[model samples]
Target: MSVVMADEAKDVHTEQLAACVRYVPPEDLKVVAQTYDGAPVMSGSVRGVQAHFREKHPQAVYVHCYAPDLNLVLCHTCKAIPEASDFFNLLENLFVSQCVYSQHDQFASIQEELHIEQRELVQISNTRWSCQLSSVNALMKNFPAVMKSLQKIRTPTALALHSKLSKLPVVYLFVVFKKLLGITEGFHKVLQKENVDLAQVVHYKSAVHDTLVSQGTAQVAEEIYAKAKAACRENNIHESSLGPRRKQKMGDFVVEVSCGSRSDLLNDSEHLKQRLFYPCINRMTSELENHFPNVEKEVMIGIQACLPASETFLCMQSLEKLASQYNIQLVPEEVMVTKSFLSRKGTEAISDILSVFKPLNPMMFPSLKTILQVTLTIPDSSCERSFSSLC
Candidate 1:
């Protein structure tokens, strides 16, 4: 629970971690879990801090912090397409070079003239996906002002940014990412909650996964393309036609052509969806699955079933498995009686449930209380928030 300056070496980390644990009172020094970002010094599978700590405390399981992992999922997904990556890079440059401190009056004046709500452009954070949604929303809300400001400036940076911003693909990407990030914004907030538990995290993660999958379909892509097209028209930005298809050649001889004429070519909307929308959506969905696979593990399932908010709350099979795994003696009749009492409280938070038992004797419901404690000990975004504040 104490923060101290130290080297990045695994040995140093291990020593510092041990010291922190030792600082706790002997009676309360039960280490059930450890959570950290996916840093090599902290999370490396072998000979890392977590590994060394596990050697000493076998009961303390390691959990990768979800907030940063979610950010990684977004970063990897954006990088899957060259166009999407460039668009975000451009967004950062625009914020750094133009919008943040300098030209505030210019942007404000433009916003007033355009009747747009005055809002500052948000700087994107590399390790925070939640901030990206804010940045994108701010830019989208003040799109006309930004473009107008860019137009009035003659500097090389502003001119280059204006040229890129006017393009059809950039506009399409803006709309697409806004929609995609919007879908995950709620889940991101949930992850940041101080009292969030595994059951809530799993529920929101599944919802985000399903929503992203739906976004990848052709119908949704078409709707997004239409929105982008309308934005381009509203801004008076020239909508360029799709470029020529790359000719497949064999030793400089044309083997085949994708289209014989303009009539055979795909429309701009269809082309954008096929080339950009589908690929981006598919990559994001895949990355979400890859980064969060452990949520479906048997141990996690059992833990979820024990939570009051879970759909399978009070499930006997899950409770028995959890008890057996933890070596806790569970009296089924006592649990059923407790369940009837808890059921009357409706779906209360884990903290609320813990408070309900604070006045009761520990021996009355040891298994349930242990499971709840373990669930709360598993980290969420609080660790990341602390690191952010320190940095």
Candidate 2:
């Protein structure tokens, strides 16, 4: 819970982190976990700050913060399609273009005329998926009003933006991301919460992974296109036909092949689904699996099983595994006695469980208390939030 300004180097971070740990009293100092962002200086495996620090404190397990990992999952997943990159850039351009006082006033008036609530456009953030979701939602809700504002301005930039928004591909991408980000919004919020723990993280991570997998079908893509088409009609924008035939290279001779009938909007929608929508969904699910493999590790599984909120709370095998991994000696019979008492209380939070032992002897179930204390010390997004406040 400290921030220090220094050169962004591995040695500097190692020194600062050590200083922070030393600030604690010698008898009470115990670094159970070290959570950090994926910066090269901090997370680089061999020569990184985390590695250097672990030499002095071998018990400190390194954890890459879930919030930033989730952000990377989204940032990389969106890169699966060229159109997604352009789509987010367009959102930024739209937000920046309206920053002028007169332009914002004009857009606000247009919203009033269209019976849409006046709302400021949200700029997409690379490190914050929630902000990206908000930006997409804001643009989607204000689509008609934005088109009218662009038409009234008669400026080159406005005209360009108007043309881009009126296109079938852009609108289709809009629909695709709306659903994608909507599915991610819940998991994103859970990761960013102040009190979030390993148990909640595991739950929501699996939930989002399953949801993305379930929604990757061609039927879902077609439904998304239908929504996009309806949005185009609502704004009085005619759907554009598919692009020209794609040129192919065969034995050094260029051959032009028709992708589909250019006049068929249904064919165009199918092409967009195959090319963009399904790939985006598939890439997202893959990234989730790649970035969060640690959640399935034995130690993490044991941690989740120990939490009262978990369905498998107080699982004996998991508890033993956790104790062994951390080298905490626990008497199984005594632990089960505590578990039996806690099962009746049904406490949801680590703090509540700790409170139940306040009246008992300090030596009673000492290992269980130590486990809970270490669990409580595991960081979530609090450090990230603190850094954000500095900005």
Candidate 3:
């Protein structure tokens, strides 16, 4: 466990890391990987730390924290839709103020009166998007009690907030985000699993975005709008249908929706669908694709090729690159010989082979053994697990 005190200076991060590494003697230390938060690793002074450390420890792989990356993706994607952004802000106030701290007793009293379990709202965090899921669940679970509490309160603030919460848009947004976050919450949890590797993380990222894109399809969009309208009807909440029609300007030609002949209520629902559901899904899919690029896929594919058991494993170019990365100078013939040997005898499971590598003679296959140790010893979800313990 290492504690790094962050400062603005670029050298400060590198100095602290070097100081820590100094504590452990040169001959005794073998750093396999370094996992850190994405922001500092990508844009902050930690870049210097990584560069300096890699100069001394060439085998160390730097991995961005998976959990924080996913959280950041969600936060950025949420900002693309006005409803989602507002939903989170409103939910933050409702959860943090009403259910968690300020008026928690009032909220609990209402829940008690309604004969429901007393549950507190989860507080939102700027850096952790998963907390939003807990907040949404708390809201949906105790919604009835929340409404009753607001209605019974005589204060102006409560009444104003109640007025907003009682509206069809607010309630509909609540339900929609609850459903959306429910899906995202699962993805978030999967990324934080101790056993999850970069390959699995990349797979989950692709699957999640693909699912979001599928949800934005026309048929699915209509189904979602229908559900929202049905919920509105069931609740007897009258939502406006006549509003500003969506417009598109193309090369001095103005194109706008002519809602003149259409039913106002239907047009309104369509507007709501366009504003809330479809855009949210599209934005999430786009943001995820943008944040988690195909380079990760390429990197994972390259790493998999280093596995001895893989039939499609390491080529000459890949072997050279891997060797260069770990500061292992390999002759072309050595790589070819290793590849030939593995092709003939690498049928054994990778884990079983790796377990025997250390005890076996390293001098027998120096290049193969060195590469295997580096690739196999790479940590998975270490950053998230470490952060969890700290919290």
Candidate 4:
């Protein structure tokens, strides 16, 4: 699709089409290929073919084309020169045969990878569903004995089972959950002969919820755009800005995103401006550091991010406090809200955050602190205790 490649293709094709020499059947070659002295019959026969194609088909190459392959051109006298048309026929057939053979070799590999991926999906579903099926089978065996008191076992337990069934991917799990839980929940209607209109109402309510959710995103999207427009106007800021230059230091970093369509998702352009931060579980950054020293670096930890608008400031303060308690250095930065060539995006805030937390993280470890404490415990405990008593 590139211009260079297109030009090359045209050049190659034009050259090949122009160079296409005439081919005659073996019986007709007497008048074409040679005269009495076994030389070409006409003086201009060889070079004239190039001139003929250039004049007639000046726009594109068409010589040595393959009608059988549904392709316009496969070979031409400019590149893959053939002594005769019969020679080209043989070569084209061989090429197709080799192509089919290569495809056959690759077919098995493609199928094998697909099979492995499919098996992983199947195994994941099967193991998770096995527990559900076993429980259902046990429930079926107790059905007749508990027919009178089925209402007792059905309500609370069935609702709980229904909640769990929602997570399962299998359709049969949903069917079984419905059937067994119905046998438990629907016992009142079956035994006492009351109306099931209330149950139908619940189904209608569920349908309404799903319908609202399906349309919720589009409705919210309209309001979001209106809010953005209002905010842009209220700040008393121009649509365009001309700010001064930013000054940064070593180790200062920012994530650059060319927000083509996602510009609206960016609430602020600052270095560390808190957005909709989701809480995630934080774990150890390392493991074997306890035994040797550095093996714990491989561990991944989960951390909570502040969200809900009001909590952004609280989370920032908590982050600073947490860093200080552990002697971790942190650098926090502000948000960039203007279209300026020179403004550094909240650099000062980010720098302050990073500085506060940088020292705390490494020193927070219990083992490191214990090691330091033991080392400073002193060689003479008796003299140290006596000196402390005097004090």
| Top-lDDT structure, candidate number | 2
Q: Which scores better on lDDT, 1 or 2?
A: 2
Candidate 3 weakest ten by summed lDDT? 17-26
Candidate lDDT scores, in order, read 0.69, 0.71, 0.59, 0.24
Per-candidate TM equals: 0.82, 0.83, 0.68, 0.14
Q: Which wins on lDDT, candidate 2 or candidate 3?
A: 2
Model 2, 41: alpha-carbon shift in Å? 1.7
- Which residue runs of candidate 4 sit more than 4 Å off their true CA positions? 1-121, 125-314, 329-391
- lDDT tens digits, residue span 1-391, model 4: 0000000012323421111122111111111111011112211324543234335433211111101111111112112222212223322332232234443244334435334221100111111223223334432332222221222234554334333222211112223232322322332222122121112222332333343334324333344334433433432223332233334444766534343422222223221012111000000001111111110111100011111111232244543433343233444432111112113344343222222222223334322222112111111001111121222
lDDT of 1 at 349: 32
Tens-digit per-residue lDDT, 1-391, candidate 3: 1212121213323422212221111122567556554444532434666556667765555654566666766688667665577668777766645743546777788888879898877777765668877887887777777777777665677776776665556666666666677767778887766544444455567777777766676676566566655655654456665455567787987877554433222335566677667777777777787666322333355455564444446566665665666566666676566656555554553333244244434576667666555554443433344334233
lDDT, ranked from best to worst: 2, 1, 3, 4
Ranking by TM-score: 2, 1, 3, 4
Worst 10 residues of 1 by lDDT: 17-26
Model 1 stretches with alpha carbons more than 4 Å out? 1-27, 99-102, 245-267, 293-296, 347-361
Model 2 RMSD vs true structure: 5.3
Residue pairs in clash, model 3 = 241-268
Question: TM-score of predicted model 1?
Answer: 0.82
**Which numbered prediction scores highest in TM-score against the true structure?**
2
- Model 2 residue 143 lDDT score: 93
RMSD of 1: 5.5
